[model samples]
Target: MSLFKKKKDELNYLIFEVTRKCNLDCQFCYNHWKRDNDPKAEPVKEGYTFALKTLKTVFKQANPKHVTFTGGEPLLAERVNELILFCRMKGATVSVITNGNTGSTTEFSQLIKVGVQLFELPLHSYDQAVHDRMTGVLGSWKKSKDRMVGLMKFGAYVVPVIVITKQNFSQVGETLELLNNLGFQRVMLNRYNLGGAVLASPEKVLPSKEELNEAFKQANEIAEKRRLQLSSNVCTPHCVVDPNRYRNILFSNCSTEIRQRPLTLTVGGDLRFCNHSPDVMGNIFRETIQTILEKSSEKYSVVARPDFCAGCMRYEKCRGGCRAAAQQTGGSFNDVDPLVNTIKENEETEIA
Candidate 1:
């Protein structure tokens, strides 16, 4: 079977960019690429009635296994609980990614009761000052930390995402220790993808391979010690830091190699390429979910593998590195992943 060909039934994950309004101005927000230059400009909130109506249409056509509600902050959207209830009614597990400062304890509990099974919260570091600085907000650390504990108390599954960057890269171990102490069982160690606002100052934001290697080393050790689950979605080339070396850490395969792709339905009713990339593949209002996935697969195939990746034993596993990262940093999907300096050989077999 052709790699890019996916059955319509294979669509499993869908994201609803519920709103563009956010409370904080993070240094490395992927969505900043589309944000207004004037910070004073009012953020846009999606029409709640229109969103729910469109989502109902989508669910009628195809019920996805997982549906995510995200935005500058999902909680900012009025009547978001109704949307959660709708997804749950459609038999889709619901998740929401938030900055953790928007809603009260009562509001959060209401969301959990309405069927928000999971919440992805961002916690840059254990140090309060560092966390607040990264978020460009004062005292946000306390709110986020308190809310994470509060959500878990409400019986909701919460994953604290640590976006690895030069600023907080050295504090990985400290952050992991804090999460472990807080009783977080699962954590995501994410890489700062080169996109959005960071494109203007990529050097200051993107971590060096050496910085990442050290961070991973700390993460691997702490994960085993604390018995915490550490996973990453960013495509780090195997040559940069082999996943096998860190037995405790889980590095996900690039989606371009997989049959099922995570599709994001933006607030404007358009489907994005993925969560990180700003590229739009199709619109939810105009195209069916199956049609969007099929067209996206064609675009995925166009992303070329790096020349050095040819016949490498791990080629199938890594897919020559993150196509989204390549497109953003190198200006083309065919460009080599910025993290890769040289091809590292596999000990068991030579490159063909």
Candidate 2:
């Protein structure tokens, strides 16, 4: 027999962190998007050449069908276009998630020409002031808007992201209308994850359960009217916001689909447990994808339904809410997600 064994699960998607350097300072940003843009700033110890070599091996071994280039802003990475082209050469369809602050419209067109099939950007609100304030930068909304329009002109499938927070939750419908008017057929609405900058004071940014439900309600109504396909970034607990209530929304819950999971690779070649968690499970440079999966099998196995979720019909779909959220708030992956369990517990106390 061969030294390496073929794993049961094949990697379908790969999330590649091109760089952590970013320009904008959005309030609800989950990751620490570093502003290391100065010429005087210290250089990265590990060069891109080494990263490229590791990525080549990963692509050859994993052969993921789709790859996403994300970062503080992927455009800031050295020779980013070349990076996208390399992935294209490896037979993976490329998608770039950017802030649209670094590159020009012409650069975006060149990216699409070089086989970047998708572009995902943030458009927080219809109002210019609201968006600029959310990003903590003036004139950013216009820049993002221009890039979105320019990408559409070049026949690129652009998915505008609307992060639902207390600040922009009420304007979800207005934002959806704006995206539809901009000629986008699809949009992604993200629930703010309780991590990074917001971890200190989640209450300041996280939307209440009522706000979340209403936001989804308006989003569904507008999507149905505008014929827009809806998708989400994080999965809300079923108890917090019932998934069945939304008609046009596509909810994402990796916990429910543990066997076929998409992998996230940080810039340093470390494989993160998930998009939300900062925990590193393995490094792509050192281990094959199959080895990482086998060694981390116990971690993945411990993420099933909680005891209270024994007979719940939504267990299969929700898998007791986001595993990262539960681990962050309740201190265990098996613990019930505080986003739901806290509210449910309070209601029971009142009944008693």
Candidate 3:
């Protein structure tokens, strides 16, 4: 901890991707792969046992503030119940991010009993037709919405995140109003990053600065009128947008909204600093998770702001949006943009 800078001590959020298998084929999946031969592209068939033991060892070694399970869809990952139980035994709060069609109410009830409190469901649009077209499923839209109702009724924190795209960006205001009407806890408006199959459409759908400003503005109206709390990312501050007093509230957080919970572990049982960094300290299967963590703290160093981002105040806000994306697009932290940096040497041109 630095004396001059208040380093965040509450380090306990883990974005555990239990599996890589997904149900719906959304064009904008952040985890989509190209060659399919990448080792990272593979999803482990090993379920709760591997994950349970891994979680147990990691939790015992480090006290996490919270644990968030995501996926291809976490519920589809077998032994989800076991992982939840282990987190509870370790006294860590548990959350799951799902598309919401993987489990039944019974499965959800089991999760709730095991101390799972936070649930995030992604709904691309309020209109079923558009959403289904985007997700390539007939009822994916309704199923996600219905599942949100279930979680809310069960008294769990259910947040819905919409990946803004040309397909759904126009109706963001309406989306907020409809979700508020449905009794949702919160909603985050995230622009569609160029990843997955949607990369070609990035500029067509990503939120304009003005659109984001309106999203924040509309969220406030829903907060005041519908008694719902709403927010948008990179668009508004967390304290002002997240509703606390009223029954219904809407809010948003730009990506990196909250410090992400730690997720990856080294092949040696040491935890990977962030999902983006492929390096590892140790492996839970080989040794103890904490032992490795304590031995080598240097491996997980925080990312220093790169030169290209040094002049941008929003650099702190973005912190190199996605390291994985950076790697994929060949845009290191030092570059202004990926495509610009990728210009071939033979293709160099001089403008008059």
Rank the models by TM-score, top first.
2, 1, 3
- The 10 consecutive residues of candidate 3 with the worst lDDT sum are 234-243
- By lDDT, highest first, what's the ranking? 1, 2, 3
Assess the local accuracy of residue 4 in candidate 1 as a C-alpha lDDT between 0 and 100. 67
Off by over 4 Å in 3: 1-11, 32-39, 43-45, 197-228, 231-282, 285-303, 313-324, 333-352
- Give the lDDT of residue 197 in candidate 2: 65
Clashing pairs in 2: none
lDDT of 1 at 103: 83
Question: Of 1 and 3, which scores higher on TM-score?
Answer: 1
Residue by residue across 1-352, what tens digits does model 2's lDDT show?
5558653336777888777777998887776222123221244424478558767877656767888888768888777788888888877899999988888766787888888988998898998898888888999999998988888888888889998888888999998998888888789998876655666677878888888888999999998888889988687778788878997898887654443555688767777666655556788778877788778867865456777678888877777776666655435667666677546655888799
| Top TM-score prediction, candidate number | 2
**TM-score to native of every candidate shown:** 0.87, 0.88, 0.73
Give every collision pair in model 1. none
lDDT of 3 by residue, 89-114 (tens): 87878888889887989889888877
